[model samples]
Target: MTDPTQDFRRHLGQHEYELLEDDWLALLEADVSPALLFETAELAARYAPGEIPKTLLRVLADWLGEKGAHRWRLEALRRLLALGEDGPDLPAR
Candidate 1:
C-alpha cells in the first residue's frame, strides 16, 4: 500500500510540505490556529503559485471572510484575477 502522506510530501516543495504538514496535523488533531492556516495559505501562494485550484479558492474565500482577514482574501482574489490575464510569471507545470 502506498503512503498517501509520504507521497504528498514528495510532490510538495520543502516549504509547501512543511506548511501542509502543519495544517494537516492541526486539522487532524483538532488544534487548528488562525495563524497556522494563514501561514499555510501564504506559503502556498508564494511557493506553489498557481497550484491552488478554483474550488480551493472558493473555500479560502469563505475561510478568509470567517477569519476576518480581508487583506489575504483580497490577495487571493488578485491572484485569481491575474490568472485570467496574460502573464509569463505563472507556473507552467
Candidate 2:
C-alpha cells in the first residue's frame, strides 16, 4: 500500500509545504538547539512535525541538553516514527 502522508504533502505544493513547515519549526521553540534542528532536517523534510505533543516536545528538548545534537536527532526520529499517521497525533482529552 502507498503512504497517504506522501500524497497529502505533495498535494500541498512546495510553497504551501514550506509555510506548513514553518509552523512545525515553530513547535520546536528555543528549547531545541539549531545544530540538532539542522541534523534532523531530513525528519522535518520527510515527516510531519505539526503532530508532536507538548510533553514530547519537552522530552526532545531535554534529550538535546543531555544527549548532544546527533543523538537527540536519532531519538527524535525514533520517537516520531512511533506516530504512524503523523497528521495530528494529539490524543483526545
Candidate 3:
C-alpha cells in the first residue's frame, strides 16, 4: 500500500517529521477519508511556509483534533485554510 504520509513528508525533514509521525500513523490506521487527508496536506503546506514551524505544526494538529471524526476535521481545516488565505496568519498562541 502507498504510504499516506509521503505527500506531506516532503515538507518536513526527519526531526520535524518525527513529531507528527504518531498522529499521522494513527490517522492512516483509522482509514481517514481522502478528502480529510487532502485538507491535512493543505494544512501541512500552510503550516510550513519555508522552514517548518513546530509551533504552527502543533496548531495544525490542534485543528485536526482527534481521530474518528473525519468530516468535522476536514471542515475545520478547510475553514482555517480559507481564513488564512483571506486574513492574517494562523492563530499563533
Local lDDT at 22 for model 3: 56
Q: Of the pair 2 and 3, which is ahead by lDDT? A: 3
Instruction: Please give, for residues 41-81, the per-residue lDDT of candidate 2 as tens digits.
Output: 44444554464333344455455556566555455545555
lDDT of each residue in 18-84, candidate 1, tens digit only: 3554444433245345455444545455555454533344455556666687776665555555545
Alpha carbon lDDT of each predicted model: 0.49, 0.45, 0.51
Candidate 2 wrongly placed segments (more than 4 Å): 1-29, 32-68, 85-93
TM-score of 1: 0.39
TM-score of each: 0.39, 0.25, 0.34
Worst 10 residues of 1 by lDDT: 84-93
Superposed model 1: Cα runs more than 4 Å off = 1-52, 85-93
Q: What is the number of backbone collisions in each predicted candidate, taken in the order shown? A: 0, 0, 0
RMSD of 3: 9.9
Cα lDDT tens digits, model 3, 1-93, are 545565346435443554554546555676766566556655665554543333333344454566545455545445555444333544432
Between prediction 1 and prediction 2, the one with superior TM-score is 1
| Model 3: residue 10 alpha-carbon error in angstroms | 20
Among these predictions, the greatest TM-score belongs to 1
Q: What is the lDDT of candidate 3?
A: 0.51
Q: Tell me how far the alpha carbon of residue 24 in candidate 1 is from the true structure, in angstroms, after superposition.
A: 8.2
